[model samples]
Target: MNLYDLLARGFPADRSRPAFLLGDGGEVSYAELEAGAAQVAGHLLARGVRPGDRVGLQAEKSVEAVTIYLGALKAGAVFLPLNAAYTAAEVDYFVEDAEPAVFVTDPRSFLAEAQAAAPLAQAVPRADDDVASLIYTSGTTGRSKGAMLSHGNLAANAVALHRAWGFTPDDVLLHALPIFHVHGLFVALHCAFLSGAPMVWLPRFDDAQVIAGLARSTVMMGVPTFYSRLLANPQFTRERAQHMRLFISGSAPLLESTFAEFEERTGARILERYGMSEAVIITTNPLDGERIPGSVGYPLPGVELRIGGGEETGVIEIRGPSVFSGYWRMPEKTAEEFTADGFFKTGDVGRRDLDGRVWISGRAKDLIISGGYNVYPKEIELVLDELAGVTESAVVGVPHPDFGEGVVAVVIGAGDEASMIAECRRQLAPYKSPKRIVFVEDLPRNAMGKVQKNLLRDRYTDLFTAG
Candidate 1:
């Protein structure tokens, strides 16, 4: 089935059934959603979007944005959602590399030099292997690579997740995550769509809004940060959350402390899962079993998981219908990422116990996930290296109380910290920028002269905790 078809498959026989209950108390119904997506599909067609063509969208979170995402799928166009935090320069890299057919920005934005003048063409029938979306993920190499998730990849995961998480039509999802990433658009949206569940939508996460949403909702999926922030709010008591059936966390590892505290406070254990842009979701804690803290749980029904390097802790490798096809325009890099046995190397270090529960130790790629957003050190280091009075910079994710991991910059430089930070803010999205900048005489290096990020992490592991 085309991933787009999932949008309308089980849409209630009653079209008036609410698909989304806006934070402002407005309701968007099934019929309205269908009409809205069809209209936006028309717009994308007018902009020359067609099957296999990449359409880039960088807009703030809104109901209209969701319409456009669904519409792009209907048009058979690959929906590429860029983070709102990315600067124009960062977006240019994606546009130039992906060579998308259409670039859709905010209505007021003048970032696009050429607009699509050609009208829509006939619909292209999409097979299971047809690319559905392009999510750009960079490594420590500093080059952005687009992961091509096929229609089959998306549909398979949605089907598995709906079953694994025990989603049902009666469930009401409290949705607050940004639509740019897999956690929101693919995982969260798909579960809600597949189950015919109504989503209580929030433009962004707010503790008060989540507290209010919990009263009317049965399910919620978020990053670790959400639970931590909600736990901080005294109003989010077990009484207020008793009605909630499940609380899912992913996009970043959930601190064991945060997991224990959330269960203690809400009387519901947070079901933490594991996934990345290349794969929608790989593993998830069971919905109706003992949810072990610090473990991401077993692989989904059809997903295969194994440790690649050793019997102890090693890089996680997975193979499943839900796994993405390959990287866009980089066949060689794609080959390098996969093993000879066809399992995709996840670049995430993990271990699986005899019972099959998976535990994430750390990322093999030195990825910094701040507030559930991926921040590659090379991206920030590139920017820092370009500025004056900077010798070198190394970025690492230190433990944070609320964000799970906060981005910290360790530098060897004479530049003024305030000025360097100002430049970063001007270029980077707020989440990727270093929250704390510490100047050291020199970054710790190994015998190979490579910066030992491990040593840096060890040195400043207490940066946030001590404060």
Candidate 2:
């Protein structure tokens, strides 16, 4: 099944049922959603879009954004979602790489800019086997590479999730994430149509608005940051969330404390799952079994995961239907990322317990080497998080003349330097503890709320100069 067919199926059976609800505005029924998508598809078709073409969407989270996404699919064109926060340079990189057939933007201010950037391609209706999206990586290493996700790839993953999650027609989803990300676009929006679940889209996350939406939603998916904000609201009550059946957390680590506290307060276990842009979802805490804390749980039905390198610790390699085809026009990078056996090397270091729960240690690149001893920052960060005054912390390896690399901790919290040092020494091993602790007002974060460790490293490299 193609991605657009997911919505087509729902429209026939539940034409009058609500398909999308805008928080401040009103709702759109399944029939209305289909009609809007059709209209948008017609608009693209009239603009000269063709099959196998790439289309750019730079709209905020709303019915229009969702409609444009479906319309692109129906037109047989690949839909490239641009992060609204991205600068023109970043946007230029993706536009040039994908060479989209048409560019759709909100705010109307960017329409001229996008058109100027995309001069050659003419927009028209979409066709099958077209490139669906070119989702760029976070560029942790160097330049961001666009992963070429096909229409078939997205549809298959959505179908897998629809089956795995057991989403039904009666379910109402609270769509609170950014549309540009894979979690919101494919996992939430596409899965809703694939499973015929109605959804309410919020332009941006607001604590009280989310609580109000929860009263009418049966399912909600978000990153740990969204949950943290929701938990901060004083008026939030378990009774309000009683209607919500499934609450999923992804995009970053959901602290064990956050998980436990949320469950205690809301009577709903935050089902922590794992995925990346290269592949959609690889593992998830079981829906029926105990929602294990720390671990992202077992692999989904179609995904194959193995720990490679050493027996104790290795990179998590995954082979699955949901994995992206390759990076757009970057054959060399694509060849480097996957193994000879076809599994994608996720670059993430992870370990599995005897019971099959998988705990992600950290990114392989983020591993800190201090005095020739290897240390995973996530381990130290978790320990620091256990301390009373700590809110968030990032561990990095700074340049050290004698040791080669020294462990440095950049933290955001209320505690004094001495107290933090004592807490780290008490909780972690000698080598794992931070040699120098720097307290900052706030850590630099990406649009997705992930701490930009590279920026932190650049900011704190001076400390290691004298060491």
**What CA RMSD would you report for each candidate?**
11.6, 4.0
TM-score of 1: 0.77
Off by over 4 Å in 1: 107-124, 138-140, 366-467
Candidate 2 lDDT over residue span 140-225, tens digit each: 78988888876666766777777767788778889888989899888998668766667877888888889988888899999888
Stretch of 10 with least lDDT, candidate 1:
110-119
TM-score of each: 0.77, 0.92
lDDT of 1 by residue, 130-188 (tens): 99999987434558789999999998988899889888899999999988888889888
Provide the lDDT at 24 for model 2.
Answer: 63
Each model's C-alpha lDDT?
0.81, 0.79
